[model samples]
Target: MTTKPYFLLCFVVGLSNPVDAMYYVQPWMLAVIIPLAGIREGQQLLHELYLLKKKSYAHINYHIGMFGSSALLAFALEFSEFLLVSSTSSLTLSVSGIFKEVVMLYLAVEYNNNQLNTLNIVGLVICLTGIIFHCILKFHALQKEKPVNTDLVVTERLLLRRMESADEWSVDGDSNTRRTSLDD
Candidate 1:
């Protein structure tokens, strides 16, 4: 088979395999992926470290530290994403969530993957629709938006307004304080 078809078949199978493992395997055992991930990341980190050490580039130490920190953060996020995908009941939903994430990354980086065939375009649309629908449903849950309090007046004006008009009226009706200035 061609590479694209093979990749698509493997992707579908990978998505399916996770579903079975998610249901039958213990949650704690799913953590095995983390250490395996660490091994993979560790290899990449070593490569970066080697490059940083060998190159007589400016800010070598800074690059090394940054690479280390980013690898650490990537590890955490990878584990978290795995947990999310495993906990989700539907493989399609989880895959779509990942698809949306990739689209967001593409938008943020302005990188063209250039594999945008009709099917990829259709999948992107479905992923975007799912993400938007999920966001809308979540927003709808908070039918009444809560007021936010902040020290900055100008920036938080909208929040203040929300607070002021939160309910029909205050139950106390803006009563005066019982304590006088002398009480202090």
Candidate 2:
């Protein structure tokens, strides 16, 4: 049997995979889709930072060039599921509840601070509630007809917003690498 430390590491790593997968999918989607969703740039940027001067055209243009991971993840999920049609999870969905709660705390605080309009607020609530229900009631549960990338993209987009907001709210960290603050 593996040692306790190894098992603990495995558990922590497993709990973190969803967040990484979700984040890995976000930036690329932001670089591509969210910008083209036909909303004002400043408007969307505000969702990330609570309130910032609207992103300049140049800023948005720069973000468009950063779509690598999102593209790869979507492609992999598609090709693997449809073309290969043989690969499987090989692991149970029994992620730790504590990890889920930690993630939920970040999500809740970000949502509370976001300045979404009435329509967006309504839609976001519906989507978030659906996600919670889906995760709790069913983990591997998926609609066979819809591509999994749809969910990945959505989660990633959300992950970006939450990360951006949290990074902005926190002191002494860059949003990119997410370096944490330290006290002497």
Candidate 3:
């Protein structure tokens, strides 16, 4: 049977904003979800390993070290992604991911002597334009929502304003604020 339909369903589910928000609210769900996913993936890995007829382990220690490093890196990557999603919206993460891919594509073209046709260039330009627009819209929205501290003293050299504590800044669903002082 074809797996396209299942892949499409998963893609649609992944793009659901409500589901993403729900996951954000209940991040503990990862404890359950990740294990289930790992089990499924581990089964697939075992099947593939079994299919291999000749498997030689000359440098078992080196392979074990590499596997350990790979696991650590994967954990670090997931942790960083969780923190990024917490600090910014999922849309921001998606846009940044696409931009990263575009950069990688360009780097490959430059360093690996990969050729890009007109269509590839056009696609890259469109992706870049969309990312730029998204960034501009997000910046303007943030600027409009940001509370300006009216308590200001205009000096000759510097424009100073009262620094609000993290608690005050984090009100009204703004969890992006970080504690700046020990007093906070």
Candidate 4:
């Protein structure tokens, strides 16, 4: 619920993934990384495209609504991915996903007042089937993977997975909290 707990889960999940290693960048690097990520989010490019569309199309309000919805969708996707990765179990992620789909469907019907015809019903069925298959595959894959050894040195190494980019030295703190940087 709190960031402290989420961060602790992040550390655990990061170490648990065998295929992908999660690296914690130095705290000082946040200054540059955060701004760089913000700049690269394509807001300016999206704005320019929207302006071009507005000039070419007669329905300016339509363009505005589309762009606004797109921005909201992007934000939603980013936040959902962050939560999904931070969550401890597949069940939590699956439930949250189902809740999201249900909310979206409700909003669509409420806003448009469109009837769910046979085609729409088929689409919904297919989508639900895909979601079920995805969950099953994910759980199966997780079960097949070898469990990681969460030793003091191993976790410390995992935490500082990509420490070569940072110019710092590993200091002795607690065994679990150690970090190895390029200097070491």
Most accurate candidate by lDDT: 4
Q: What is the TM-score of each predicted model, taking all chains together?
A: 0.30, 0.22, 0.39, 0.41
**For all candidates, what are the clash counts?**
0, 1, 0, 0
Write down the lDDT that model 2 would get.
Answer: 0.49
lDDT of 3 by residue, 1-184 (tens): 1223322333344532334434443467667877887877988767656655546555556757988997786666555555566445555666777766877897899999999999988988898888778877877786788656532222211321234243345543745555446637
Using lDDT as the yardstick, the better of models 1 and 2 is 1
Which candidate achieves the best TM-score against the true structure?
A: 4
Ranking by lDDT: 4, 3, 1, 2
* Model 3 clash tally, residue pairs: 0
Question: Candidate 4: which stretches are off by over 4 Å?
Answer: 1-73, 89-95, 140-146, 149-184
TM-score sort, best first: 4, 3, 1, 2
Q: Candidate 1: which stretches are off by over 4 Å?
A: 1-39, 52-103, 106-120, 139-141, 144-184
What is candidate 2's CA lDDT for residue 85? 18
Better of 1 and 4 by TM-score: 4
lDDT tens digits, residues 1-184, model 1? 4323432343444433434433444456558877887777988767766887665777676877987998687655544554554443234344556675786668655765545678877887797788777766755654556745532324345555677666434345577444434754
- lDDT (tens digit, per residue) of candidate 2 on 1-184: 2222332343344423334434454577668975576465766666745433565455544455555665676666543332221122312222333344446656766976745478966876686666666565544454343555444334555767887877655355555444445522
